[model samples]
Target chain A: MRHVATNNRDPEPKPLSEPVFLILTSLADQPRHGYALLRDIQDISNGRVALSTGTLYGALRRLLEEDWIERFKQKDTSRDKQAYQLTSEGRRQLRLEVERMRQLARVAGARMKESEG
Target chain B: MRQTSMTILWLYPAEYREAFGPEIVDTIAQRAGEACLQGLAAYAAFAAGEFAGLLLGALREWTTKWTARDGYMSPPDFAVEAADVPDLQRRIQQLIRGMEFAIANHDFPKARLYSDRERIMRARLDRLLSAGNLYQSR
Candidate 1:
């Protein structure tokens, strides 16, 4: 029997950039198209991160290339309304990112308390 | 404004433009609409930002293309279909040729990049084949 190599190892997740982190977080709830992603990202950041369409699509392409997201077919298959959803890998990465942030915050809080005392 | 935005969109690499052009245009239109509601200053700022972003994005994408790290190397989820086997094979052949040419030219870095792409493509091909999807041998 020929041994077929299975490339199934999950590599350790690196710390994500801010835009990537926001994009993944936006898709954590449900699938969204280009415009929806832009709006939601802004809303998520409380209007601080207003991504231009080019920047948004650039990030989307990278996410797709990483296999962390996939194009979702919806009834509205109009030229501009293609939706995207997070893959399981993407969700796992997001969860890991959140945990990383929580731990950092915890450490910072402890140090602040020690300083105050 | 839409026309100007489209013109800027044209500056992006052909593959990137084809994949996301219409959506980017639509998004820009929607953003412009929202900006229109906020008054002239907001709309002006939005237009300035949009043009600058698109120009910078086009430059970056073109640079990425020249650097051999475009979509050709990455296995996007969409490429998993069995129907893509032939296309994948063709890409693998091209990568081999590219690697050989790079070696002949003493461009070892480029050759290594091609080698990496070949490995990834072959792995993807193996996965598709192992899934038991019948594809015509090419």
Candidate 2:
């Protein structure tokens, strides 16, 4: 067995990048393949964000490394059409991010209302 | 266009290429097909952005390969019982053998699949061994 370093730990959870966040959101509903992820992300972002294949795969690799997403064999799909889905940990992280944004938006709205009044 | 993209994919690191090359190619081909339906200009624009993205992504993957310690490759945080060691070891061995066979046959995608499974099993094995050592020290 290799000398496994048990001391290394994950640091604090930083905010996910737009691409990462979108990718997670795309997979939140169900598993998707590479092309599917690209289309879904575009739809979710209302065509504002068009992820290149390279960008999509880069984020996928990072997420897989983090265990936030997992690859699973999907029926009726070719071997090359690898599909990915969000894990429980990924779902939790996405929820946290949504909550954070919601709170920020609420505060901003309240501040604007006070100024208007 | 796909041939061009396939050529560009070679710029990525071997591990990354083996893992994602086909999927990237398939996605690019699909996008290209969609762009073709719009017009020549649209297809050209898509090609330009796609190629540039592939170049930058290759650079990023190389940087990650050199600098990042993959979390999955590290020792796991979960505990493992003594009895689970043998089963984990067996699975790891099976996965490694499968990976090797796939590699030998030039089935990189299949090899990558085996490698991913093997990595998880290896992590579990490490946890079990670590747990045993901790027990011995006590």
Scored by DockQ, the top model is 1
Q: Which tens-of-lDDT digit does each residue in A1-117 have in candidate 1?
A: 111232423465678999999999999999998888999999999999988888888888878766677675456744535788887768988998899899999999999999999
On lDDT, the candidate that comes out on top is: 1
Chain A TM-score relative to the true structure, per candidate: 0.86, 0.86
Q: For candidate 1, lDDT tens digit of each residue in B1-138?
A: 789988998898777877778878888998899999999999999999999999999988887778654344244334443236777788788888887887789877667666665765676677556655644543
Clashes of each: 0, 0
Give chain B TM-scores in order: 0.63, 0.54
Candidate 2 lDDT over B1-138, as tens digits, reads 789988998999877787778889988998999999999999999999999999999999878767753322232211122236666666667777777887789877667666665665565556557856744532
Give the CA lDDT, 0 to 100, for residue A62 in model 1. 74
Query: What tens digits encode model 2's per-residue C-alpha lDDT throughout A1-117?
Result: 222222213344678899999999999999998999999999989999999899999998888766678775566534545789886668988988898889889999999999999
TM-score to true structure, per model = 0.74, 0.72
Docking class of 1: acceptable
Report the error of model 1 at residue A94, Å: 1.1
Instruction: Report model 2's chain A TM-score.
Output: 0.86
